[model samples]
Target: MPRIELKTKIRAKKEIVFDLARSIDLHKISTEHTDEQAVDGKTSGLIGAGEWVTWRAKHLGVYQNLTSRITEFKRPDFFADEMVKGAFKHFRHEHHFAEVDGKTLMTDFFDYTSPFGLLGVLADRLFLKNYMKGLLVKRNDTIKEFAESERWKEVLSS
Candidate 1:
C-alpha cells in the first residue's frame, strides 16, 4: 500500500476546518474541474460516522465510481474513512485537525492498495501517487479558501 500524508495550515478554527473537510457540497466545488458528484448515500451536508457516499468523477480521462464510509469520527479532531467499494483493492483516508496558535492544522493520511499488484506498484511509483497527492492538495486548498473566509457559512450552515 502507498501512503500519502499532507499537512495544511488554515487561518480558521478547528471546528470550521473539520466541518469543511466533511462537507459534500464543498467537495463538489473543489473538484469541479473533474466534474465530481455525490451520486448516492450522503450526497450533501456534513458526513458523519457510519455515513457512506458514492462519488462519480472523471479522472485521467476515465470516469469512475467509488463509495467510502466513515469508520471513525471525533468532532473537531479526527475522522477516518475506508473504501466500501472502489477501483482500488483497498483504501483508508484519515483526517486530523488540531489547534495551533489559534489556527487549524489539518492533516490527511491517505493509504491505499491499488489493484493489479505489480502494475499498481509501478503506477504509484511512476505517476499515480503524485496524481492522488495533487487531488488532495486541490481539495485542501479549497477547504482553506472557505475556512479562512466567510464562504464557509454557505456550506456548513445550509
Candidate 2:
C-alpha cells in the first residue's frame, strides 16, 4: 500500500472548509478531469458517518463507477471515505481540519493499493504514485480557491 499526505492552510472556517471538501459538486469542480455526481445522496449538503455516495468517472482512460461510504465523520474536524468498489485493491481517504487563529488547517491522507501484485508495485514506482500525488495537489489547490470564494462566503454568512 502507498500513503500520501498533503497539508494546506485555508483562510476559512473549519466547518466551511470541511463541507466544501465533502460536497460532490465541489469535488467535480475541483477535479475537473473527472465528471462525478452524488447519485442517491445529497449532492450539495453535509454528509455524515454511514452515509455513502455513488460516483461515475473516468480513470486511467477507462470509465469507472464506484461507491464510497463515509466511515468516519467528526463535524468541523475530520472525515474518512472508504471505497466499496473500485479499481484499487483498497482505497481510503481521510480529510482533517483544524482551526488555527480563525483559519483552517486542512490535511489529506490517502491510502491505496493497486490491484495487481508486483506489477502494481512497479507501476506505482514508475508513474502511478506521482500521478496520484499530483492529482491530490491539484485538488487541494482548487479546494483552497473554492473555499475562499464568495460561494463559501454566502454559506458561512448564513
- In terms of lDDT, the poorest run of 10 residues in model 2 is 149-158
Query: How does model 1 score by TM-score?
Result: 0.99
RMSD of each: 0.6, 2.2
lDDT of each: 0.96, 0.82
lDDT of 2 at 15: 76
- The deviation in Å at residue 94 for candidate 2 is 1.0
Write model 2 residue lDDT over 43-157, tens digit each, in one string.
5555678988777777678778778889998887899999988788999999999998888999999999998999999999999999889988888887788788767654334
**Candidate 1: lDDT of 61?**
98
Residue clash pairs of candidate 2: none
Off by more than 4 A, model 2: 39-44, 153-158
Top model by TM-score, which number?
1
Error of 2 at 12 (Å): 0.9
